[model samples]
Target: MSEPRPAYYAAHEGLVAEARPKPELWRLLVGLGLVAVVVTVLNLVLFSVVVGFGSNAVAEGFLTGSTPLAMIILLSSFGFVTLGVRMAVRRLQNRSMGSVLGSFRRSARQFWVVFRALLILGLVIAVLPPYDMGAPLTPNLGLSTWLMLLPLSLLAVLIQTSAEEVLFRGYIQQSLAARFQSPIIWMGLPSLLFALGHYAPAAAGDNAGLIALWSCMFGLLAADLTARSGTLGPAIALHFFNNLIALLLISLPDNLSGLALFILPYDMSDTDMVRGWLYVDFAVMIVGWLTARLALRR
Candidate 1:
């Protein structure tokens, strides 16, 4: 007999049936478009709200600095993505939006469980041979600032990264998996889309291709973890902690560097530097997936 399907597979049967009852392809496309519009409108509203608060530094602070207000505004747009997905799911599936999270309590439990494991994993990575974290970005923001931003930043990054998971892993992956019996269609298609979206030809230059490859590999790992654990929690845990280290702990000093704790030494637009970083990123992605597997093992 074939192996049993995961619980999420059974739960989402309505969405993936041949009848396409929960969300047909046309509906999916429309939902995404609707999300795009909502995100834009919400961001504009947030920008207005921020500027009206008697602080007129949206341009400089939001684009490049350590302004706490900018940090919140810049990264909070992902909340809208979460909202958009919820709207789409509720309208199309007529199911409680919680289904996307798989098992809520279980997923939340798994998230912290995996997060602890990954933090130790991060330390292991940092201490590994031949990997230099390079210099910290200039002008440390002090203890109080970091303490203040810690909770807020976690909230921001969680919203940002979780929104992505909801879209790619929860919405897109589940939808396809519901429609197809094969893992290739359900898994690979979403990974391909995720990888393509990560490509920034202008910033990545020649390494954009490699970056896409790494992202695709990451998506594969995340998708696998989601299936393995029977919930989006492990995947979200893996993604959130990974990003917590990257975006908050260390980051490229570019337009998006406002909230980063450490700025990388190398320039993001440099082809050679980015290419070298890609190698390390690929290694990390593979290692991360393997680590998640270890954490989920019975």
Candidate 2:
């Protein structure tokens, strides 16, 4: 049989009909959900174990002991778990693992462009005066530490963030699109869920609201990018870069950092400062969306 025309396949009417041709959406979603649950549980357990060990070491005044190693191990394990699940799912579906990996391979060039653009954008935002966000750069890390760990840190950020993109933008979004045939369901639902997953227990007052709003907006932009590109490349790149810069470079207030391992030197206590920085983030999302759209057009 001949392959369906691209235009026909892209249409909502035809896409929805095609989505029903296979009876695997629910099964795929359930499997992915199970993996997510297992990862979450394991992370909690690992974190607790690490904290316990760290507490004992700290009481003994051990300089070499720190939670960073424990944190890295937890994150690495989560990445492996997700990868294992993806491999298992592909085998069960009789799909080629090579094809799954191939999607990520084909988008390599675009990924670099996306990363560079966001990195520059992040640098600009970090240096702006109103926020004085760039002040945190001075005490970021020693040259030796940066040279030694930056590469590993970048890899960790990429793996962690890309895993999210693959699960939500690639797997979940595609699965929903294949089943419902409606852009709203495939695109909107995943984004909303993603936003909710970012909810912080420490958020209070207006800060809580702001965090929720930002999460939702980011999710929407990512979902839209996935829909336009017909792949998770742009979203994955955006997410990875957003996190890399935020973790390694950006200097926002302590509360705004939201579970960061290190705190920035600058005090971001003022509400205006937070709002201004948020506006910059929103602008970046607009630029990211435009970039993804143009790339997809090519």
Candidate 3:
């Protein structure tokens, strides 16, 4: 007799059940191609319009600058990815976007639960001693100004994080799981692609590989959460808080520092210090994952 499927997969089955009937490799490839075409064309049109109205330098700022408006624009563009995924899933798989998420009500409830748990954990971490870097953080936005922009900034981050979860954990993972029995195939493949997306040699220099590895680990944990919960909620909540801290709270001095209240003193190329911090972040990530898992029990 064949070994039994894992308990977590019980919930995941619902997420992937619709995909199984149409789990053709050609369909998956075509869906990916459609996503690529959609995002590329949309971005091109969006940026072209920006350049037409604004100077080239101004348009570039939306991509690379550290200002709040720039950050918002950059983060919000991920919405196009979500749109692409929805189109691909609906047209290719003959499934509603809601089906990709397993259950809408469960997802919404789980998201808030995990988010609240993480928020409390974040507050606790903030108070911990010996956790801070020695150098003072550079303030990017004034307190009053940051507070004023908080609502919109939060929305932008939710858009970016949820879009990613929808693509990786929602579309890709579900599609793969539908076609394969092994978690290694479904979970590992999406995590690999997600990691590759985070690879940035130009920005991180020597730390690029390490950063990519961290991203891979993050992807796996997020995938596990998605599988266990049978919804993108837990994964999205995990990603949301992580990005909220990184993008809106404190970020690296260079790259994606826009919308942050404070920027780190050291750049990504500061190998020794950055690597040390990455280790701490890795620990924190595991803890966050465990916390989310526990939260789901309640």
Candidate 4:
């Protein structure tokens, strides 16, 4: 006798079926290696081109610094990861690009549905009391400049978040679930990898472990939404909106604050303050996940 499939995973069979043909762990590992190589080579090429053509200051800041142009370039480069995923799926898995994405129409529709729910939640949170952060937020971008850059900034964030969802939820989760019956193996593994990617000790410093733990829980929640919805839409929407708030709206002054409208007085290394904020973020994330689930139920 087999274990019964949970109701939340009702739509996951379609994704698993798509992965059935090339479900080998070796294939997944090799595919990831290929993606890394592709990303490296492309970034190197881009770097060389920028350095050869641009000024020394711009060249130096392009990858390491957080100017608006630098941030846009950095975020948009994640498209290479999406391209690499496509290539790997085509070559190694012998599958179409659509194979990893479940259903295009369903994904698109769900993206809007979840995005709308989150947008409302965001507005409600914004209007609630005690909005101040114990200090006034420093203005980062001029209103006119930010407005001018909004379209491109949004596109960059969409690319970054969607690329991540395509790789983690669409490719890794689907492939793992196909090979393993247990959600612990399939969901937990990809979520762990996703968490590892966010473990930034150099930046987060003393708070790095907690930040990574937060990322792991976030990944688990995202993985859950993907499994339940059977599309990358909800996860992508969640990630996109979260990042939109962090990167485009208000941000930490020390990092990635270029395109933001306002900047926090404290940095990520301000562990005590940031840790408390992280708890708030955790609560918001949970509510957002539940909201997404409820939206799907409608």
Q: Which lDDT values do the candidates have, in the order given?
A: 0.75, 0.58, 0.90, 0.88
Clashes of each: 1, 1, 0, 0
Q: Candidate 1 or 4, higher lDDT?
A: 4
Model 1: lDDT to the true structure: 0.75
Write one digit per residue (lDDT tens) for candidate 4, span 136-229: 8888999999999999999999999999988988888888887788888788898899889999999898888888888888889998888898
Would you list the clashing residue pairs of candidate 3? none
How close is every model to the real structure, measured as TM-score?
0.87, 0.74, 0.97, 0.96
Cα lDDT over the full model 3? 0.90
Off by over 4 Å in 3: 1-4
Mind giving the per-residue lDDT tens digits that candidate 1 earns over 248-285? 77777665665666677777777777677678887887
TM-score of predicted structure 3: 0.97
Q: Assess candidate 2 and give its lDDT.
A: 0.58
Q: Write the per-residue lDDT of candidate 3 for residues 129-237, one digit (tens) a residue.
A: 8766768888988989999999999999999999999999989998988877888888899999999999988988888899899999999999999989989999999
Q: Which ten residues in a row have the lowest lDDT in candidate 3?
A: 1-10
Q: Which scores greater on lDDT, model 3 or model 4?
A: 3
lDDT tens digits by residue: candidate 2, 54-159: 6765422222212334324533554855564575456434444333333555467657666666666667755876664544434534556655666666676677
Best by lDDT: 3
